[model samples]
Target: NGASRFGRLRQTLAGVSEKMLTQTLRTLERDGLVRRTVYPEVPPHVEYELTALGQTLREPLKALTEWSVVHIEEVITARGEYDDRAERTR
Candidate 1:
């Protein structure tokens, strides 16, 4: 909903390694999809927030999530069919 510090993001995204998260954040920042802000303090503070361009993806991503939930069974069935055909050719 707003800016998120690294620790907060790491907590929210379970199983994501710090290195991977840092890389992903850097990539997003480079792509203009996210903004990174560093604050001067005793220990230094940093936060990441989505850019306007990134915010535009919220609806589309949500739609995709909904679609996947609805069609997951079909996707699994298609994968099984493809695997069966491949096994027949071997």
Candidate 2:
């Protein structure tokens, strides 16, 4: 999205550091899950987009993201319940 800048990606994913983000991008590129494009110029422009193989991940990842958004409250509630039970057992 937005020409595939790192800042935009970091914002979307949240909590990704510069180093870890670079590593993740390289890993995906190596695995043939994503393609990196570079434009040769001063202050070179770059873009990262999913390859066909990577596009295959869209469905599952999208589903997971949607599920988290929908069920985050339930997850937090479960965590609280577990912590309460643990405290009571101590």
TM-score for all models, in order of appearance: 0.81, 0.77
Candidate 2, residue 12: lDDT: 85
- In candidate 2 the C-alpha lDDT for residue 21 amounts to 95
- What local lDDT score does residue 87 receive in model 2, on the 0 to 100 scale? 100
Using TM-score as the measure, which candidate wins? Answer: 1
Measured on C-alpha atoms, candidate 1 has an lDDT of: 0.98
Tens digits of lDDT, candidate 1, 19-71? 99999999999999999999999798999999999999999999999999999
Q: Give the Å error, residue 76, model 2.
A: 0.6
lDDT agreement with native, every candidate: 0.98, 0.88
Model 2 lDDT tens row, 1-90? 324867778888788788999999999999998888899978887888888889888899999999999999999999999999999999
